[model samples]
Target: MLKAPDHQVAGHQARDGSLGPLVDGSGHFYKPLQNLDRGSKELAFYTSFNSMNGIPPRIRRFFPSFHGSETFQASDGSGLLPHLVLEDLVFGRKNPSIMDVKIGSRTWYPGVSDDYIQKCFTKDMKTTSMSLGFRLSGLQVYGSEESGYWKPSKKAVQSFTVEDVRLALRKFVSSDVGWASDKDTLPDCSLATRIYGGPSGVLAQLIELKEWFEDQTIFHFNSCSVLVLYEKESALRGKTHGAAVKLVDFAHVLDGNGIIDHNFLGGLCSLIKFISGIVAEANKALHGLESSADGLELH
Candidate 1:
């Protein structure tokens, strides 16, 4: 059976009269097709991306595996619609923490209408996107099944500062912390070493993606989001089954025409730098604890 995604942290959502993405019990995500131009363009990009042999195998894992398209009845009673079938990133997780980070200071593409550019520009300036090269669209952190998910209001997220962005990244990987009450204080960041510091962690994966973005000029991903996800349950158990980094939202993707994608690259690097700092701080904190423990033993 298909239903609305409970873990979706951002973007368009299903409402009274509108439809959003759907997930099946079989671990498949179904995204409703947009307008003719955008829907077809996105499908083409995925098809072409998967078919191309030159795309490095290591980088390909960063994208959700596409399973083509399927026609399904719309949730809003708008009849049938075509949906893109993809791997459900949070399908099997018991308690998943997901964050959607939209890369690039500019979201519009070349040859777009002036009005569209202006709209995007205004929003970018209003948020951290313009200055920091990226913005946290939205996120949900697992706070136990009884407590439910902890997410900030849309207005609060829009008003976030540079420090707020860094804190959000740290909070995303933290556990059992009061996100709202402890806004000014730092979380334990105990999961930092495991979730963002290790070989298969988010930091390493992002650096790998950055390396690919540095050279690839085949496509310019406009307004695309990098989803950082991990299951709190699995992470606490010291398992890596649910940790991943996946690129999503291809409606505005454009042909690169051999030019470098400086916008996306710059934003990705900014995110990486922030993560690297967090890992370093977490290591120092751990070292401090160890030293204190040794001092106590000597006494």
Candidate 2:
């Protein structure tokens, strides 16, 4: 049996008075669901990723570790729902600033082939939005709420915008000399150096991850949420600190045969191109700042 913290409610209550998914005191995130097929797919994804020979360690570092699942019956004997448990990514972090942004879709463009675009739209409209630009759909800062359950923080939500993404992309593009110069390589780099902490190590890691995903060829991340986490104090101090980017929500993952899926590739390429543009714009702004700072020093 799952036990919630004494001070915190286990799951969210719906308008119908039924319980939703809950997190236990042990830091296990339980996602309650009625769809068994979706649950099974997610379980398989976690299982495959968690296996020793499955996903690469560098790429796997960004994923939340999955535990297992159990069927929980309502106390009132109303019905049962499968509770999928996984390690809480935001747990134990001090005032962790978290943003759950749906990836893809926002950066899409109309210039892409109609057939490809239509295929992507048919597959998933949300994922196709990445070609448009980054859009802030939901934001949450853990620990701000007194109840311990995840709640949206207004201040934190306002802090990040499509502009921030642009800036981060600039930092990534400017600092990623290797990937930027290599015309043979795809336009992809790490956001860690720009927004989070340290140098450009994570960019290389991200490239490796992208390559790994490309190599798979059989599966594609249909729709996923990019979870960005950072310490509030670190962000407020304007200092480099620990931060993480995790990909979650695999309900829309698609599988295919050996043939390459152009629609999938198109979506991925669009997202990469969008990030590159954002980063380029950000780099220009950073150069301006540096020039101003240099002028002040010269005086």
Candidate 3:
């Protein structure tokens, strides 16, 4: 099953599957203001959905060993705590290229993809955003960053490769399909037959999951406070694509009070506005804001 990592909230309360808050997400005061301490972690399931490879909850049953955790401390002694963490979760596991046995479309077999991203702590670093990710199914293909990240930088500790575990995970998750080596019979299923909802549905689920993805990595660190981010890939009719769902990150407060006012959507809109202004001022490309029917914040 997909086991979630342990975590600290707002750099204070600590939470795990067993230990939980006595109240809802919003409460108040050490008086049980009632919370899952700053240490409480988010669910890091490969696929939080009901299916994987024709099997129900494929991501969970397949990658059983996938694990991770986080801890936080207020570095400035400002009553807010910073967080620290370590984990081995799959982020970019698809290949940049693929060939489908079916048609003219290029396909990826959860293609070779795995790597680490780092965030550095600086005096001016006020925002800490994060997100879970949504990936295309039937064909696992991930693209690359065309350019470097804009501002500050944090060096990742090591390199990662998706091929290291993709085969194993596929074996583990796809019960009906079996492993590529098995050469098993074609099960009474179609790739779409395993579809819990539809392509759009699966895409939406992936989009939402990105939040916890960062919670285990990006959000887990020593800082002013905790900031959770999430970006969901959208359902497209053509080639595969990935979208950024996560946007705003809350600094330190030991209780996650900063984001009390903004939900994930609100935070994202704010971020889009900020980026739009910057690009406009710098005369940077607005990507496809003008031509595309989808209205981006840069308008």
**Candidate No. with top lDDT:** 1
lDDT tens readout by residue for model 1, 66-122: 999999797666989888999988887777888999999888877888998999999
- Listed in order, each prediction's TM-score against the native is 0.92, 0.59, 0.24
lDDT string, candidate 2, 1-299, tens digits: 45432222112333244555555656787766536475677777776666657556767787888887877764324678676778767666665645554555522234446875677565344322443323343544332234232333434333544544443343232223333334454323333325432233223333444565567765556546556566544544555535666777776565646645344444445444554344443444556555433212211
> Per-residue lDDT of 95-131 in model 3, one digit per residue for the tens?
2212111110111112123221122212112222222
For model 1, the run of ten residues with the poorest summed lDDT: 290-299
Can you tell me which runs of candidate 3 are displaced by over 4 Å?
A: 1-92, 95-122, 125-238, 244-253, 256-270, 274-299
Q: Best by TM-score, which number?
A: 1
Residue 227 of model 3, lDDT score: 21
What would the C-alpha RMSD of candidate 3 be, to one decimal place?
19.0
lDDT for each of the candidates?
A: 0.83, 0.49, 0.23
Clashes of each: 0, 19, 43
